[model samples]
Target chain A: MAELNRLWEKRRTDNFQMQLRYWNLIGKNSGLMFVLYAMIIIGGFYYKRWLDGLPEHFPGLLLISVVLSALSVRAPVRTFIQKADQVFLLPVEPELGGYFRSSRIYSFLVQSFVILVAWIVCMPLFFQMAGRNPVAYFLVLAAAFIVKGWNIDCRWQEQSIDDLIPLKILRGAISFLFLYSVTARLFIAVPAACLLIMLLSGAFLFHRQAARGLLKWDRVLDMENKQAMKFLRFANLFTDVPQLKHRIRARKLISSWFPVRSFDREHVYDQIFVKTFLRADDYFGIFARLTIIGMLVSYFIGNGFYTVFIVAATVYLTGLQLLALWKHPLPQALAGMYPVSFGLKRRSFVRLLFALLVIQTVALSAAGAAGMKSPAGFFAFLAAGLVAGGLFSLGYTARRIAKENR
Target chain B: MDPVLSVEHLTGGYSRQRPVLHDVTFDMNPGELVGLVGLNGAGKSTTIKHILGLLDPFEGEIRVAGRTIRQDRLGYRQKLAYVPELPELYEQMTLEEHLQLTAMAYHIDRTTFKERSGRLLKLFRMEKKRHWFPSHFSKGMRQKVMIMCAFLVRPDLYIVDEPFVGLDPIGIQSLLDLMEEMKKQGAAILMSTHILSTAEQYCDKFIILHDGQIAVQGTLEMIKQKFGDSRASLHDIYLAVARGETKWLN
Candidate 1:
């Protein structure tokens, strides 16, 4: 018993150390903690006022909280416990139960603290609108807490919530109806009907898991760790990862145009970069995703067309220019062995960088111009893109070349 | 034959405060395969880094094909090729793409690249794998790809480090055979390895580094006379030198 306690303490210490290492490296930058809390408090007060007299937008507070919670949960906290390491540390498995139990308790307290506070403060508002007695409100609130707690615990255990698809959908419908119910007592039948529906739906969720019952709690934990690790790796993309799992895709067309195949070395280099851009998923993925999202955002927001065009163009160009510098260090290993000259490589990179900027600018500007009827805005937008994408990339390329020479 | 590579009074590291490599000197002649033997962190890599000009020499210059790197950066580098300790390929590029990029960087004519790469691919037994992405390749295969690319250029000086790692015995033999062929064609090879027996058997000269400095450098005959151990093998000499049991002739 004493040994197990010691082992649990050691595991907790190790976990704490790992957390400290990450926080020390990149401190908590998520504005969700404070900003969301403030918004929730302010929103609850406004919601109470509306619920007292005008009962239409009372559900707005619930919708807002759901959005905030969803964002908070998916907010990309990158510190993941490694499953492989856990497997290696399996000799201390007995101790891990207690350790994880403590973690589960801690997580429950911290995560639900905000929701609890919000519910308490909004009690008057929920009662005023729904015209519910204390007993009814407490029962509903109890049910809400149970559902939230179960969901959060399931998530921590790394079980797929997707497995409960129908139940989840049903619950989602019920919650939406619950939100709607706050508008009037006519909606009371809706939420009251949902309460019965939820108990039934939750039974289905538990039964599905029971039918193909898993004895491998460890495996469930492993899956949870893996899910956590995946999120961490995605977050690491914006930070430094020593061993990154880079998505590699081959492009054969680029190889065909090699050896430049022509005296106009500049033209050959231009063709190579174009092929590289088209073929390489890493480079192409960045450009395509940014452009697609930009277009979509513009479509939805209905304004800021020029803003989308320029922002997307700047992102694509900056990445290309920086890539030129990174490629510089690689060529050194080959430079001494082959007849490849630094001057030629420099020229190729410079030309490629310029060509990419030029091609993208023309394609994007034309697209923007076609949609935009304002001739002055179109031309001004194109010119701004040319300066930001063209002049900036070229200037940076030149600076890199100079630095390489040094 | 004239020496293909010469490093004299070289002193450099990644930084000034703590130099990884101290004043070091060695030479490799045409048709000679000289192995650089050392323990880990003993500056074997740092020495190669200096030779490749990935690092600048703080005190002395590195000369490839009888020209200082600084005097003619392009010309000096043009004469040598390096296969790093671990092959670092562009994950997005295929085997063929790597060959193509090397050909372009070296300015090989299209016809020549096609002709040479086709032959080299068959030589390395990687003809069918040309269009395969590097990510799909195993460690041995990735190392082979790196080897194939280095050999494609046929540079005057080949700077290969830790080549035996990630190579099957067959791959190792093939690489050694290629090195021998390159040597016969009058190219110089500066290779670093922990495999002393292989170095003893194949190398025309040896440079054993200890504590980031040259401990002993010469042919077997020269080392025997200098160390006064005529019967001792290369391994013995290396151990003795590393452990400070023997003093090498300055």
Candidate 2:
């Protein structure tokens, strides 16, 4: 293995370890786990119910091919190159082939996991369209994997060439066509052979470019940073990724409601914390989306008793995510420099969180109650959710904040 | 009058087992600009953090206006402001909001805040950009925001670390001019910088920190004489100190 390959391994290992820790943090929250579990079960139940009702005229073949084509063509190539590498590693560019080769293989493997899940998802439709054959499933999957490998390799090479949008469009079309042939036809050997030929030819072209000059370090670094940011943003949905630069939008209407009145010792942290919660990094979005989702689930589940669990679980998850507001901006923020006693901060945060959670409980309860069309169930869910929300925002939160001070 | 800021035998770092700064001590008199000079990782930032009351010193006490941070946390901090090397303005805040927040944090009255912030925005030529978020601003502009926020507090003491790094020439000059004006108004400043030319030209006194200890501290003329040549530049003194680190490495 090249030295750069070892470096890549180290970078990826550290990256995965960081992600694993964040994922574990998200997992440890039992409220979130319950919500996710309920969603998956509901989703699975609906999926089978819908599948059984599929009409004979359903365009299952076209849909599966389009999905598989898109999946295979949309290959993600992550080169764990930090911006600093352009300065330090430029001298050793020629020796970087092994590093990039490892990257492609690793990305192909990682992306394959997603493709496999997608293919398995397409299984029911595929069986309906082309009759049940386990061998055919593997054969079609093998063909799609090969096409995906080619797409990843070609996409990596494409970074070297200046991307006029048309070139990207053309490459996407070419890769999609290859995967389309693999998925569209039940017989796989002909398309498999055809794909291998195209892959070889594609390699030859990129090899000629390599023979002529060094890899475009700037282009590679930019692509890597973008891909890494995409992954981090996705991961941020679960837990705070501190290194990610936050995007702040000034939502004028939403902000108008929570004005920073007087900037005094008593109101400073409260005013700012609420403003940060409402505007900074989609705290409002998470709260609103989770509340709406909880309501929708409760309404549609149509079972008043289960609506209690649904509303409780939803409010809990919403609280858990919104607590990121505290975990993120409150702790790491320069707000620490405020002259006020730190106790004031806790008091303000607790009040803000309780108020927000109370609103979520009311919103979720209204929808849930209306869905059951029973005032009794509505009050029941309202009480249940309020208790859950109150416990989370008060007792649990106060303890958590105190522990942080220690 | 007592020094506006004082540190007595401070020793601490991020980790308790492995201290980075060792017995570092300095003082800042009101209306004087003291330059803190050191190599990278030579405890300049650590020293500034201690002065800001961000980090607790294990072995010593820091005082602003004759009061330790523990004794008067709010009053102690109210007397100080800091400009970090990288502008750490809130991403969500407009330049106007940052000023307001800083003023509010220090409990500045609205009337005073408006007047001060208005003057600051004009002085930095950022009045037009008062409503712009930092994400839209270039490096120099963002740095100007940091400078404006620090000055907004109108603290008795300012702790600035490498304030010139991302600043354009004009922005740098504006900052220098502002520091000069603030000094005349009896505000003390402790600035850490690698730019020897800037320090030698602007600073009234100097502290050369080496390996977390004060290698030397005095006026530029006094430091030059200690180097055994009154005409020798501040650059020469710094290079001589940096070469000591080279000796350690080899």
Candidate 3:
């Protein structure tokens, strides 16, 4: 409907304003950007070396990563684009075609950027194994990219791969064969024959899926687009990008923390912090993600006290970073006038922060120590986690006090 | 009854160098509904901010329940509840969670919190939607959530900035009735609004602020007497004060 399209446009405009506001608050931190680009370049180089042995695996891996990335991009980007004023634009639904097209195109480009880099890195490895036949490789790469673009667009329409399973399986197989045969450095005729078979198989699958579906592509596209938008909201926290609120049904597990009985202010504050951290995406997401990363590193890198130390540091950093926003901008109106005593409020907040740090550290350190078979390392890491958490809490309190006094 | 809120020689702004309100002073006694009138960028919010202790007074002091925040931070703050012009409920928090948090922050007992929260939720007709997050709420619903949170604790003073902007007619009536009931209990209200007709009907006193200073302050009859214009309405007086009408001043 015309109304829905208008709503989408208005939402986009409002989201742009919010993004600008956030950026203004935190001036462009170019250092973080530089570090990210540097990592990408470095990772590209590392992958190139790693692919020297099993060159056939590179294309398949790149294909999987690209598809997954495209699917994941929708959630955060959509959430970012949704504005509070979107209700006003609700009537312009008929014009949503333009908006959806532009969104899909933009998402495809972003999704492709990383894939292109990965492709470039793996290309050399393929050539080295298959002999430097640039023409054949370029032709295949071009075809693959075209298929990929279409695949992303299709995915955006269909959403889950289950909706078009045959197409997905066919695409996966073709991509697999394309990488496997070509990079195996087989005979030129063999690759040429394989490419022809893949082309026919993909064309058949596309036609089959395209024929069976009588439903409007736009409607499907809208649903897929919304699904993407939801994921984007969750992703925004990681990259300071826009996203929709990833609507997740909260699991009804351990619902015991309600209507806290502790009359003491400290206990009440603790319950508030604990309940929020335990249930919400924002707090637990950071804790879970950082700890997972630490566990991965320890698992792959060989574990010890060093592993526990790194996990502790990560857990502490996660708690500190997550709580940083709340401590700033001084809810100026409510901050000064709240019923609770300043000293008591600060103490409760610090205690809450400490509790969060303890949970995160204990979970990660225990996992790290379990991997390392070191109780001593666990104790050491726990101490380090506590100290780091305490210092971080103190720093926040000091900042608040200083701001108030000033 | 004692004055619930008093501002003396207040001057402050979002920034220190550029003051929005200059030498502004007024008082609101218990059970009085005082409308704070101002044009766009007339420093209504700035003055309210100073009163809430969000911004420090560059040249004055604000007292809620007869105690300045600086002198007795907790006691000063405990007497007032502020409903901002825009609802800023935590998007992640459910309506009930928001009420619970407010109750906890004010240290209300469990029994009192339950009773107050239930009554407020029903008053706003949001009892069924108590478990819903602000994310799922409409503009009016979000505003209702904010109103519920502000009223959950029976503070001596209620400072509401633009409370009627997003409400339905019934919601507006509900809010007015709630304020009326609170007033009967000797609570003081300092509400800022551009909605003249509503304020004119409901407010017992008016403080017309122009260019960050009090242009005039008093009950309707008192203001009419001072301006020597019994025929003029609150809107007329507001416009006269805002435009700095030479004749009215004379």
Candidate 4:
């Protein structure tokens, strides 16, 4: 049991460390961080002002209750059971109840933050509208904690039974009604709590009955693997996660865009890189998403230095993400055996980067220019984008490649 | 005629302070197949890496077709194809795409590439899987892709490492036949493997490596003469050398 606890601790630490490393990478990008912070502060101020000026007839309490209860009902347990657990820990299942108890507690603690934040955010609106006493608000918080713990336990019980979709829906609907009564300050709070307790007791009985049946180890492992991959995928957005196995799709239509006609050695690498960019799910998805985001940002900001800032930032990010593509061929032995000079590979990569950045720059600058009625503003933004693209591809990317090769 | 690959006193490894291969020396001439036999960690891969110009030799030099990797890097690389022990492929690339990429890298013209790839695909019974990505390939199918790519180049030399693992019996026979055909066409092959029987049957000569150095290298007849045993099989001679039971005349 202690060994299992230690293993769980180590796995959690490693996951936490991976997230921290990528977060630090994101933090290092000062331009993106500045934009993000600026947007958040501005948005928060507007939200507070709007809340203060709420109309008298607004059902703010009902809205808050519904959203909070919806959030509270989704209590996923993070078991942290790795694939090796099946082989190594199966024989010791009798002793794992304590380990699972710890896991449930950890899940409850982690999930409680959402309910807490919802309460805090909605508290200001609640007081302005309901004119409720501070004591009553604290009661709501305490009731929320109880409901959250019950939801976590119910979810854990639900996983043991296969073909329980209807049961899950019924539980969700019942929890929503109970939470709604408490948060809406209905006279049914006491009875709602009683009903919740009865429901939870029934769930416990169901779990006990199912516990005698075979454990669904495959389903549990699959769910756990998916949970871990979600975090890894998030971290991958900031920096490369080498352990993240990339998902590939044929995308036959999109791949047809990069027709292979090159027989020359240099052109062959260029073709391969382009085809890879178009066919690889992650790279193509990142490129398309960033390009669309840059265009949208430019459109929203209307014409100004902000548009240029967004365009430049998006280009940089796209280029950075595409660096992972170069690593694709690194593991392939035939790539190393290619008779072409190393410079040729670098040159082809630079060309591809330049082409992609230039396309992004043109589309974004054109969008910005459309909003700016002045031809001078349009030409200026266009020239700036071209220059930034050139500097990024020729100078920044070249230096990075040089550093890597060295 | 010059030997296709010449490694003279080559010494190298991942780190400079402690080289894995010490003074490794050998040569493979055209129309010959030399088996590089060694145990795991015996520096077969390190030696291949050095010959492929992936690592710089700390001492001595390697020449392919009379041109050193440094003296003519592109030309030296152009004359040889390498098949690694473990297949490493672009996960996103289909079988056809991989062959096309190989053709492009080796500067084979489009017409020649199409003809050769089609013939190889038919020969390997993989015509139906030309559009299948490596993610869908079984181990033998992936190995066939590597072998097809290597043969498609039609280079003067082939560097193969553990070529028989995961191959079906038919695949193995096809590979052996292709290698023999290449040998008849005057191409040199340097293959490293642990399958001693296959090595003895197919290889024209053997370079037995032990502890980072070549313990003995010669034809079966020459090896028998050197070991003073007329009846010993190559596997027996190899085991004897590996166990340090041979007394060399040198």
Steric overlap count per candidate: 4, 0, 34, 0
Off by over 4 Å in 2: A1-65, A78-88, A105-150, A175-261, A278-333, A376-406, B1-3, B6-29, B38-50, B54-63, B85-96, B109-144, B207-218, B221-229, B235-250
Could you report the DockQ of all the candidates, in the order they appear?
0.24, 0.42, 0.23, 0.55
First chain TM-score, candidate 4: 0.75
lDDT of 4 by residue, A1-406 (tens): 7886887678678777877888888888788789999988997899899987878899886787687767777777788887888988899877877777777888889778888888888888878877867887776777667767877776776667776676667666666666667666788765466575647665565577467566677777886778778877887777767777557789898788786777888876787688778776478888888888888787778758887787778888888888777776544577778888778888898899889988888887777777665556566667777788788888988878877762
Compute the lDDT of residue A111 as modeled in candidate 1.
50
Pairs that collide in candidate 2 are none
Give the TM-score (0 to 1) of chain B in model 1.
Answer: 0.95
Tell how far residue A128 is off in model 2, in angstroms.
6.7
Q: Score residue A380 of candidate 4 by CA lDDT.
A: 68
List, residue by residue over A1-406, the lDDT tens digit for candidate 3.
Answer: 5555565567667766775665553445666568878999998788766765564534553444344334332321232233332454345534555666666665567656656665665566556655678886665555455545655555544432236666566555555555444444457776576567655654555545544554344345465467555445634644544233233334336435445565555554455455555555445666677768866665455456567567657865786666743443323333344566655655666666766667777776676667767777677767777777767666754465446532
Consecutive 10-residue window with the lowest summed lDDT within model 4 chain A: A197-206
Clashing pairs in 4: none
Q: Per-residue lDDT for B1-250 in model 2, tens only?
A: 9999989999988898988899988888989999999999999998988888889999998889999988888788778888888777677777787787777788899899889889888887899997777789998888788788888888899989899988888788889999999999999999999998999999999998888888888898887777777777988788888778333212
Which should have the higher TM-score, number 3 or number 4?
Answer: 4
Identify the candidate with maximal TM-score: 4
Whole-model alpha-carbon lDDT for candidate 3: 0.68
List the global CA lDDT of all models. Answer: 0.65, 0.81, 0.68, 0.82
All candidates: TM-score: 0.64, 0.73, 0.66, 0.76
Tens-place lDDT per residue, model 3, B1-250, is 6688989999889778889988998989989999999898899999888888877888988888778888887677777898988877654456776777677778888899889888888888898997777678888888888788788888989999999999999889989999999999999999999999999999999988888888888899999888887988898888888777836654
lDDT of 4 by residue, B1-250 (tens): 8899999999888888999999998889999999999878888999988888889999999999988988988899899998988998888788998898889889899899889999899889999998999999988898999999999999999999999999999899999999999999999999999999999899999998888998889898898899888998888887887777857636
Model 2, residue A90: C-alpha shift (Å): 3.3
Candidate chain B TM-scores, in order: 0.95, 0.94, 0.96, 0.97
